[model samples]
Target: MRVVTATNAVKDERQAGGLVVEVIETTSLGDRSYLVSDGEVAVVIDPQRDVDRVIAVAGRLGVRIALVLDTHVHNDYVSGGLELARLTGAEYGLAAADEVPFERRPLADGDVVQLSPRMRVRALATPGHTFHHLSYALEGAEGPVGVFTGGSLLFGTTGRTDLLGQQHSEELARHQHASAQKLASMLPDGAQIWPTHGFGSFCSATQATGDSATLGEQKWINPALTLAEGDFVEQTLAGLDAYPAYYAHMGVQNTTGPEPLDLREPVRAEPEELRSRLDHGEWVVDLRSRKAYVVSHLAGTVSLGLDGPMVTWLGWMIDWGAPITLLGESREEVGAAQRELARIGIDKFAGAAAGTPEELAADRSQLRSTPTATFSDLAAALAGDSDGFPAPEVVLDVRTNKEFAASHITGAVHIPLYELKDRLGEAPAGAVWVHCGSGYRATAATSLLEAAGRTVVLVDDTFDAAAAAGVPMTEPGESSSSS
Candidate 1:
């Protein structure tokens, strides 16, 4: 794994023998798109919907992009493979089973694509990640340099099979096991695994082992290798949880062929326009820091922080077709947010405004304070002895069941952040105190609740901090950790 540093993480570079695989890592999605070239012709794999970055890289490298290949119709973000191919005059290739409603080179198992005389790419039908996934094996003059495993086999575990829906989960899990076995059996010990997901992707069923792992090392340590087919399926299915709501939209759009992206500049909106849009029920997502958001913000405006996983939550909590407005601390921050938001196929940017809450608000009345409480503050409130406490309407825990089950504050409501949208009614009304392992999901929860006209308090503290603060809590092994 040889790294070539350039501008930043967005357009990083890596080497595989004679191949230069430019890594476009979308930090928000925890996914990577590769622009691989054997110094003559380039091929892009699992590209983000924003195709300009890939194009820019290709232009810099001075290699003609001959092909655009997708591992599968992605669920996490819109596929830019088709759009990039269209823009570059490159031949686009996807799995035949994906049934994409347009013409392209239908890639199949064992199909060899010659990059050059000495360099070639062989397609391997690695199903289980959406049932139409393909892994491309790269062969250079020095035997096999690497395998682009996509979602079939990852750094530690394989991509979760349950994203297609509940009915197909079990069957897909079985396919995933067989697919991992196949890759391990066919590929040599030294083959470098370049996965599209699993660095920090939720698509990974479990935590990442490390950045990258070899086929030989994975064979010994990967949990997928140790389990039988049925047991593997059962274990995988059990670990699955709620995915983003926008995921339901990606697969169908890919099959029907996505509309070409509009990468034009976002227009600026005035404070008066912001108020008018909000009055008309359009979402104005503030991409400010969480601390800034909690300290002071527009009364009804929701905070989707500029840092961390903006697209996933933006897609999940907001309607895709709905008109949206963005607010950031500066024009540059707004530009950054717009670029990331576009990856999820959100192109409808009505306008954007860059200002603090004071400047953005038409009147001081539109500004409000959303307090951030720590676990200690939460404990004091639950005890009903803290001064000016209103009996703490709900101590909401927004972490996954895995984290929640580990150790949670007593009397806290358990609702995973991903599922909070549809289950809003299940949450108690008024003064809802929210906390996750850290404050990211808690901020998300806060914004969600605040958008729905409920008062929210972010538990902006670590789980261990809460435990150390002597907040009434239950240990992991306790029969009941419920408050």
Candidate 2:
């Protein structure tokens, strides 16, 4: 078997009679996912949080993705496995015993999957980092080649086994040791190791020094593998940094399927066609970063700030089934934006505004503008008294539950903007005041709540301001009406 190294170093290419592997690097999160294929059929591995890159790669290669295999349910970020499967109509597969929420082909230990005549994958249950983790060994003409070690083993360290529960500390360590030893003994010395996470990822205690490694080398230098199982378990659990607050939620979301995002459909509109569609009351989503959006953006376009948490924000703001248009810096950017949005289950792309900003601006009558609020304005609004308003009882805090729990205005109703729609019944009706950690999300929430026929007020205040204003706040463990 011949091993080929794939990294985020380049773009798509057609090689070996259309058998190609493309690595799409999502720089926003410094994450990489691979698309492996042999012309007629393809499979995606450890899909990034965004599904757009995979879709674009598949489209360019003229191949249909038949399956999506996630190395494991990730903790650092959300998974796009389900989203990719939905978009490509491919079957999603996970380790046989995985407890994730979506239906998938349960890949068992020692199960061999054929991608083509020459390319095949053998599933090896490697469950140190996570109970359901699996690594695939690639086989070709000569023998077994590289293994895709999701989080089980990296260049320098092994996947942390402390995540599941404190009680499993000993079990995880023992399992991890046995699994690593098993892999080392079974694979040839020359077999390559490809890990899902490299540096800057919290999954591995020790960051990878190189992108890839050999099984023989890892066996000698990897601390976890060299130690006794008991010591290995204890050491792995001791030095772990605090897991990110979002990990728990992300885990559950991956297991139970995240709610769908509302992405606009891709439109190829002429000036007239674009204008007619806009007149018919379709929403325009500008999927650019906050910085790019601030410098300049289209008129009548709502800024979703396609930067951090792109899919999640889009899912919360855009309408799932509405006709929409995109305003991106380039065609590739627009396409990437579309695919990422789709992964979260948003598939409506009405088309992009086809020309330069000035060209699209030729018809002034077709445009409207959304003004951004300043921090000062937001503070003033929050501090202002609402006693004279028709309904003074409604106060909505839009931050995460943890952020809200640490400290928040007492008696304020809590409805995270992301979970706002489903939890709408929890919101008090009439003249509701909404505030997030800052004003950005509050503006979006205000617009949504108002559209739902509730009178809403946008509060401009940082969390500190609320505290200083003598607004009664809730401590982390304290139960309140909001919780």
Candidate 3:
């Protein structure tokens, strides 16, 4: 794979003659997917659940989709391969070892399929990302042209092995090294690399230099090929980091096969119907500005700002398949959120409501306001603790564990936003003051806290204000950390 490091490395489009390669970038996840075609026929590799974009591209290219090839059942996001395959009369192919309830072409190592007169693909058993993953090497009559390195050997290194669970992490890491070596041995030095996960994808074991890289260059940088297997495994395993809670569900769903997406527009709900569903305990997602949401919103609604990366937080925080009602300032905003939700196959939008607060919430008592506090306000609260420890007024830092360790308000409870849904008990019993590096994640945390009926004070200000607020910051390996 070629490592294109420029921030704009991935353009809206990239092509390769009859073998067209379109980069489908999911910025929220920092992941990349692709559509490869031989002019007459096309194949989508590791696609997201939203199939409309791929379909539109196929339509514009006048190429019929002949196959939907998944490198493996993904762990991070729902697979659209099965659904998209079924929709376009294309065969869905997965490694033979990936046992699922659905019907699909079973691919094995050394299996070569001629997609067209000039296009051919060979499946190589590159199992490290997942035990059943397959990497397809493509040849377009010009000898070995490009290789889809799925989660095998990424832009700079191989895929992480720990996503399977702790019990299998080390073993898988060893296997990952071997797989990367195996692919490098077979592919030509000049082969073009097209990876499914690149840029800042969590699936990557090491920091990816870029997406557009060569097999020859990879041999120089890829530890699996350059270092001893023992050393390679150790480094890769050490580089492993945390993934999201929703990831555990993806593989299972892809193996069993996801349901076809209902592309029909979400039904618009009247204010009365919206209120009734809220009374029934259904979810209402507010896709408005953070400022607007904290000002006046339904008592139990979760606010994920539409102006930001909306879908990832929703999938991370909300339960899958649970009915959700979307509320936006306008129909346009609701539609944007709906499209974002569709990326992860969340089609259970129960209804949509768009209007001013006074109009939507006719009962003003149902309207709840979240009060905000700056870093200085929190510092003062902590200074007054008689026990010399802040408790009753807790400073809940909801940034990533890495960020929290770098610098944070002393005695602040560290809970990354993604894990809040499962680890809500770790939050303080005292009044919670939620904040992140900035207010982006704090807004998400507020919704979760409010949903669970916990009294919370939203710390919706910048993290840099900590110094001015007298909140002491510390680097890693410091005594200030409370875990």
Candidate 4:
């Protein structure tokens, strides 16, 4: 584990003694899959549901995939390890303690998976991210090169412990602490740490910082290493936030052997079918920019733009296994969204339509638009003048609880975007203006509110621009405005 620069640039490939470790990033899901090869043979770790990417990498490197391993039963994207193994005629591996229906090369603590004469992976039971999580230390003839930590030890923090359940969180936190310490002691200080989660995934207890790190570097920055076990457990639990609701299905899908991904184009939908799906309350996702969506869209279609975290938020907001139809500006856009959804096990679509809002609409009557605003506009509105824009009866902040607690518009109603689906009744009636940290979540919130028959305006501006726009802000527990 050579010390790379302290900058955020993460190299897609790193060199070991005689091996090349290629990083396959799923930025949308905020996870990384690795293809570690000894030139002639390779081992893929923590692949996503779309195994094609891993296969493509292996083919490009001209290496035969000899083994596919999972650090744990993932709770984020469905694991592609099983399917990748089956496709490549490679042995699938995981903790022997994990009870999965599929047959795998069950690996226990200290099990060695020899990849070549000079390269091998030594499995170490590193439970706490899950009950039976295992981290793989990639060893070269000289010594260990790096460790594939999965969710056990991230760059700056550990994986969240509550995904299994709150009842087990404290106990797991203790295990997580011990696990991180164990890795620190077993591996050399210079061994590079390759983690599967924590780039931006909710799997991390807190957002992990830094793009790369060594065991020596992490010992100074990672809470699991710096804090006492009890302090680490308490801090880890307190830092946990709401993860995507779709996570509840991933572990089960992984353990049962996820179905091979279906990247084939979905059934082409007509305007009439699109309207019917919307009418019946099926999820009709609009894959355009929020700016375009605000100007016009099919009524009731949710705004999960392709340019943002569409997959994570859509997977979080939609009812699992619900009929979903995609509406995009082009076939490519629809295809791209479909591929991303597949990574999270959203394999089937009710239908998909590619066209402009006008073309997708059966009639002009089916089209609708919402107003857009900025905090400056809201500031003016509060002063009884808004350049003819209607003054909002309610200022709705759709940012997360932590964000709202840190700072928000004075007198704004707080409802996180995820909760808006069920808490629509809690929103005050009349003209409402919604916003989030950025315009993305706010755009989604506006469409949701509008579909529920509320008059909504989207604040399509960054939150940092609020104070500069002369909007009064307040922090929670403060009696007076901050600025």
Name the best candidate (by lDDT). Answer: 4
Models ranked on lDDT:
4, 1, 3, 2
**Per-prediction TM-score to the true structure, in the order listed:** 0.93, 0.55, 0.84, 0.96
Per-candidate clash tally: 0, 17, 11, 0
Comparing 1 and 4 on TM-score, the stronger one: 4
C-alpha lDDT of all candidate models, in order: 0.81, 0.66, 0.78, 0.89
Error of 1 at 384 (Å): 4.6
Model 2 clash tally, residue pairs: 17
Per-residue accuracy of model 3 over 401-473 as CA lDDT, tens digit each: 6677678777778889988978988886878888897798899898889878888878788998887878777
lDDT assessment of candidate 1: 0.81
Model 4 misplaced stretches (Cα beyond 4 Å): 1-9, 12-16, 479-483
RMSD to truth, every model: 2.5, 10.0, 4.3, 2.7
Candidate 3 off by > 4 Å: 1-18, 199-201, 206-211, 220-227, 276-281, 319-321, 343-345, 369-392, 421-426, 429-431, 450-457, 460-470
Best by TM-score: 4
Local distance difference test, candidate 3: 0.78
- State the local distance difference test value for candidate 4: 0.89
* TM-score ranking from best candidate downward: 4, 1, 3, 2
User: Model 2 compared with the native: what TM-score?
Assistant: 0.55
Error of 4 at 1 (Å): 8.7
Any runs in candidate 1 off by more than 4 Å, and if so which? Answer: 1-16, 384-391, 451-455, 476-483
